[model samples]
Target: MKQRLDKAGVRFRPHFKTHQSWKIAEIFSQEGIRQITVSSVTMAHYFARQGWKDITIAFPLNLREMDSILMLPEDVTVGLLISDSSTASYSFPKSLLKKSVFWIELDTGHHRSGFSVADFHILTWVIDKLCSTGAHLQGFLFHDGHTYNATGIEEIREIRYNTLSRLSLLREFLSEKYPGRNFLFSGGDTPSCSQELPMEGIDEMRPGNFVFYDLQQLALGSCQPEDIALSVLCPVVASYPDQGRAVIYGGSIHLSKDKLTVGKETIYGVVCSEEKQSDMRLTFPGDLPFLTALSQEHGVIQGTAEQILNLVPGSLARVIPVHSCLVVSNMKQLVSADGTVFETLNLHSVDF
Candidate 1:
């Protein structure tokens, strides 16, 4: 992924919100990934202290964290996301403002966050406030999250093109008004970034899920099933032969409640087996089962007679998570490919 971006001359600022582990982050650091994007101030501080020189808290900036953001060491560059004019009202210390870049989050039809393109008035209002306060309005940052729902490559391409087209118009407008100032347009989402998208106007990519694709990505066609890098290791607690269901000791908490519709059925996760556990890459082989339902502590996997017979009490079953980010976020620890255990950020307890 880095090679592809480097070849295209697009800056890679991988989002760290997917895996909030410093040890996991070192893997990227070793690959020359000095800059990163995160979702929270806690994550920004955590990565900054680990010697990451550039970090962007991609989520809308929290006004309450101004003090903490100001306290960050001068050597570490921090960027903030501002999606609305309300955020522009908060005053920042001159020192902090000088060291920060504000990416105006553009709503490229995602409807989740950012100012809508049709509502250019909001963008103008926010820009005016930033300029008045001497804040650095870097450029536009976008994530076409709607692409995640796309079922085909062409649909994804259409969504990406629409987003870029809107961004190009906004970029032109910003350039015309603020002459001679370089304004960047950054865009990313696994579905759009994993595939080739129009990069004429986009200056950078900030994809986080590509680091750990999941069943959701597979279903979205963002990646092949073999590209998925993680799965849930669950213990088979009980087996009901009459019903042909194997109950596992993993559920919504372990594998998030995120569901994907495959055919007519909505599944929480795809199931693999203990025998194939050594091969972490999940293909959801035909012989494997699937998690049909999940409770807080129990996951019910249904399979054929041969498959159900294979699962026994005290045995382990591997289930590919629907969403890797939510699964990792809820967990306190993770087991690596080499069977080494490492702690993950307890995001639930984090103040931010």
Candidate 2:
């Protein structure tokens, strides 16, 4: 991964929202990753406490958290995303304006937020206001979130091209219209970042989920099962041979209900008997396919009576989550490779 970014001449400022561990953050810091991206203000604070000097809250700046933002250390360089609203421009405390860096987000392909590339007049107006405040207009940042919906490599490539084209056009417009204005062009998504990066005009890339990939990335052809670094461990509680089903302690509370379906086949989660065992095999038998039908306090596994009978009640099962981000966020704690329990990090004060 480092070699790939080095070859492209693009700096990597990995998003730390995937694995919110201070230990992992230190690893990146030691690797010379000075700058990092996060999803919330609390995350910024958490990593900042862990000794991160530069942090960018990729989401829109929260107007209500102005006081909390002000309390951060002055040496900690902070960047906030600004969009159509002048709220961030006007609401930000005048004292912090000089120290704060504002990146006008551009909506290239994903219609989530930010001023659209086509809305040149409004974008320029926002930039003018931000520049007037003397707050450093730190380039542009965007995420090609729509890449997740891509069905094949061709679609992924098209999304990448369109996103880059849009961003380049906007950058060129900014350059010609306002020359000598220093700025950085940054964009990334797990799929596009994992495949190949085209750093024509981009200065930085922020890929979050690559640290702990999941089934969604696998289904999208982004990464293989070997790239997946996390899974849920659940103990089989019961086996109903008559109904060809078994129940596990892991359910919606442990592993989320998110599922991936390809044609008629549905894979809720990949099952393994152990975590440390490298030769761990998934529990789907040849004759009876395993499926997680319902999940609450129990994960209902479906298969043939013979296959169901084979699973012992006291056995342990490891289930690979369909969406690692959501599953990890839901978990309050995680066990490391050595079986040490570490509390899961939380950024959002309110549950999403």
Candidate 3:
């Protein structure tokens, strides 16, 4: 990701929500990444304590977390996301707003959060409110999350172009309205950042999933199969080779419930040996050996007769998740390929 972003001359503030491990962040620091992004104020707190000065909480601003946000060290710069006017004016202290970096999340057709570029009235209203409240207007942010629905690179590139064009027009309009004001535009979805698209109006790229490409990104042509950096290790609890089925001690709790369906088959994950994640291969309906269905505490692996004939019930099974971030979110820590242990922020805590 740094290679692609550096070559394109775009600032890389990678989202730590993918790994959520401060130890993993050390690896990023070794590669010269100073700025970062997270999904919650607690994450910002975790990384801030790790000495990350520039932190952007990419999720929408939570009015309840104002106290926690304000408690951070004075030097730490926090960027908050606001999707509507109410959140902007609800109860942020004027002094906090004075030092805050406000980002208006833009809905470039994902329909998730934020004002759509077409809904200029609400968007403009939110922007005006934030600016009036003394928050530093940090310009627009668009997540091409919809790009995940694309068929290939061409579709992803098209989404990227269209989003940037819409954002550019918004930037122009804002600049014309407020001359000499420097509004920094920044946003990135994994699919958009993984490709060789042009970074024109974008100021910085904050892509989380790119850090650990998953089966979803792989299917979208955003990354190669080898680029995936994380997988879940499930213990084989039952083996039925004659029935071409196996049961593993991994389910929604371990891998999350994210899945991908191609033609007649639904894939929760790709089950493979320890060495070759791509070796078992995932094809629609028939190529064999995929994590076909998942229950709360068990996962069903289905394949051809020979595919699972060698399985031993006591052994461990490796499964590549469809969405790495969701899988990582469920894990309390990460076990590397080399058996190294890495700790992550425990969002599952009762306090969180």
Candidate 4:
């Protein structure tokens, strides 16, 4: 992903919420990426303690967590996201407001958070209000999350193209109005960053899921099978060869309940053979293995009789997650192939 961004002529400040492992972060640092993005203030703390100096909390600024937000280590330059004008005017801490950089969140099409793309009133209002108070305004940042539903690579490219074009227009409008005001346009979720999308208007990208491409990214055409880097290993407790299925000790708690539908059936996760997992390759079409059912603590894998026989009694089935970010949060730590256990956030992985 860093190479993808570098090729697109933009700076890479990837979101760290997907892996959240300081040890994993060491890998990113080794690649010379000095800045990062996170989902919450607490996550900022986790990475900050690891000596990450430049961080952006990608979520909206929580007036509730203002205390903790302000207490972040002094050396770290924190960039906060704000969607409402009120967060810039009265509620924001006056002392910290002057020093902190604020990025106004604009909704490209998601409708989840951020001000509407059509409404520049809230954006200009917040910018002027913050400027009057001597606050460091960092221009516009958006999450083009709607690209998750893109039909194919072409559709994904178009969605990203249209978004960058619109954001460019807005940047010109703001530039003409403010004259001499320098604003950095930051955007792009995994879909846009991973696909062959336009980056002419994008200054930086903070894509988290690209770090560990999942089954969802595979379905979106944003990543290839080999790009996926995370999976949950489940132990099969029972198997039925005649029934062509096996029950495993992994479920929603281990792998979040997120799923994607193929044909009329739902797929909770992808089931991979031991040899396939060793090579780190996945097959998503034409009789690809998958989990058919999931409860709180049990998952049923439906496959051929041979597939079932191989999973019989105490064998391990590696299941690729539909959402790597949620799975990482659930598992909390990662065990490398060499049996190196890497801790994440505040939780330790189950030591074997």
Predicted model with the maximum TM-score: 3
Backbone clashes in candidate 3 total 0
Cα lDDT tens digits, model 1, 150-249, are 8778999999888778877887787787788888878878788888676777899999999889888877778876677778888999987667799999
Candidate 3, residues 226-298, lDDT tens digits: the string is 7888878888999999998999999998898988986678889887655665553457655547888899999
Better of 3 and 4 by lDDT: 3
Q: lDDT (CA) for every model shown?
A: 0.82, 0.77, 0.83, 0.82
TM-scores of all models?
0.92, 0.89, 0.94, 0.93
lDDT of 4 by residue, 118-189 (tens): 777777787788788777888789998888887667877887777877787788888798898788889968
Top lDDT prediction, candidate number: 3
Error of 4 at 214 (Å): 1.0
Of candidate 4, the 10-residue stretch with the lowest lDDT total is 277-286
When summed lDDT is taken over every stretch of 10 residues in candidate 2, the lowest stretch is: 280-289
Local accuracy of candidate 2 as per-residue lDDT tens digits, 250-314: 87876777877745666677664343334433434433334466467788777778767766799
Candidate 2 TM-score versus the reference: 0.89
